[model samples]
Target: MFSSDIKIHIHGTSFTIHTPSGKINISLPFLGYQNISNVLAATALSFSLKIPLKKIKNGLLATPILSGRLELIELKPHKILINDTYNSNVSSMISAIQVLDKMPGYKILVSGDMSELGKKSVLYHKIIGNTVNLYKIDEILTIGQISYEISKISNNGKHFLDHRQLNKYLKKIFFNKNKITILIKGSRNTRMEKVVEYLIKESKKHVNFVV
Candidate 1:
């Protein structure tokens, strides 16, 4: 839809949006083409309303990072946490995985099942697994029944029965890794945000929650 109206040229962390009036250069703090698309959607509406390009640019820049949606937190120096526990689907998963793939460090993907997929549940899970492997994500930890399909296909993935098992496994591995980026994702039923909570509390309280 934006192909003709809004032309986006991406270079590194910033992108230039071409418009009828001029250009709007945007540097969103978060990652993903989806976010840029969203910005374009807003920009299109704004342009139609005759809003100034400067105001649109400022608004895009001023937009805050929403929690559990590409929100960045430092577990420690060089170790980053991506709290993408807001929701889960094939599209969102791929976007998050792509973001993680670009980051330089020991990458870990902590994921849970994408519910209500009906007949294509297994296929969806397999796609996620293949994408992770294709992107060369270091470790893929998955929970729940359907997500087990992800681990099955991922080269470095391991399926866990529950959060405790996953946590224990995480503690065992990553004992020596110094620089790491951990992205947690899941549907609401999976309650993957608890993993984020567990990491936060454990990072502050204990010594075993490495990486």
Candidate 2:
């Protein structure tokens, strides 16, 4: 999908198409080469027939982001929040921290355990903690069993056994409006978003609820 009229060369095949959006080259998996070729031929036919851009965009927009990927929930003048807690692995954890480092504002990491990696579980948790510390995060609150290990390795973060303890502390001790950016990331099983609920409780009062 080239934004301008340009030739697209794929494998040994080459053709030109007019696309208003940026050029996109899709490499189909090699399981069924004939099927992929057939689809590509059909798509080319559509282009030859001058298909409407609205129809193409509608088809593209039907697809959604993959589950357990970075999902942005809010962006405010004082804060930004991401629901990247859908899943966690070493790669995903590092990516989240990198995003925090590049963004301007105090970063709050709300992390939990990354389960089912078996033997590497402890090492993975420690890596997440190490990643958090390597960044200039203002504060960190960890949840879940493995996340407790993350807190142990953290230099300036706290660990919570449950949201109950976290809520109490946030409401009583560390409550601040628009003063920080929050990253709520963890495994889905940990239900870390309960902490986000606590933030909303305070946010309804017009406090800056930056993500």
Task: Choose the strongest candidate by lDDT.
Answer: 1
Please, what is the whole-model Cα lDDT of each candidate in the order they appear?
A: 0.84, 0.61
Candidate 2's C-alpha runs over 4 A off are 1-68, 171-177, 205-211
**lDDT for model 1, on a 0 to 1 scale?**
0.84
Instruction: Looking at model 1, report the run of 10 residues with the lowest lDDT sum.
Output: 168-177
Per-candidate total of colliding backbone pairs: 0, 7
Q: What is the C-alpha RMSD of each candidate to the true structure, in Å?
A: 3.4, 9.3
TM-score against truth, every candidate: 0.78, 0.62
Candidate 1 to native Cα RMSD, angstroms = 3.4
